[model samples]
Target: MSQYGAKYKYGKASPSDGFDCSGLIFWAYGKHGITVPRHTAAQSKAGKWVAARNARQGDIVVFRIGRRLHTGLVADKGRFLHAPSSGGYVRMESLSGVYWKNKIVGYRRIV
Candidate 1:
């Protein structure tokens, strides 16, 4: 997913081009033949809920940024991969960071 960084677009989900937060997740799971929703709100309810402390790789990390929802895929126990804002790139970030910790709403297991 590193190849998708820096050039991310807000609504497109193409790996050769760019992606939004939910679009990135949708594309990643689609490559594995798993179908998921196209919006963060729908995606948030697509999988079973899991506690953040028990989150594992592949779990969906949901966050509430002001009045908007954001999502990322768990990369490990304490990190997640996501396509950030329109000007940001797809990157792995630590969940323990103050910014994420305070924004995190919950975790979900898509599989």
Candidate 2:
């Protein structure tokens, strides 16, 4: 994850270039030979649902932002790594932050 910090690009999945939200997830999992769907909606349903209280590192966190879905990789109990937006790069952020907390839908464990 350190290799990807501050690197972001819309609709790109390459680490050498950058990544979007789901693309980041796709790249990280692919590094471990785990394959996941490319879209956030499909990704939200790809793994078994885990209650937020049980979330651990590597768990996929899903969020509902207006009519679209967003995703992040849980880095710890209270933080996650994500490629925030067009102008933002991949970064670690607090899940408990008011903005993220209110948008969270659930967490999924792929492994």
Query: In terms of TM-score, which candidate is strongest?
Result: 2
TM-score of decoy 2: 0.95
Question: In candidate 2, what are the lDDT values of residues 13-108, reduced to their tens digit?
Answer: 887888999999998999899999998889999989999999999999999999999999999879999998997889999998989999999999
For residue 63, what is the lDDT in candidate 1? 95
List, residue by residue over 1-111, the lDDT tens digit for candidate 1.
544454568887877778889988898888889999989999888889998778998888999999999999998879899998877888889999989989998998989
Considering every candidate listed, which one attains the maximal lDDT?
A: 2
> How far in Å is the alpha carbon of 58 misplaced in model 2?
0.2
How many clashes (backbone atoms < 3 Å, residues ≥3 apart in a chain or on different chains) does model 1 have? 0
TM-score of each candidate? 0.93, 0.95
Model 2: weakest 10-residue lDDT segment is 1-10
Give the Å error, residue 48, model 2.
0.4
Model 1 worst lDDT window (10 residues):
1-10
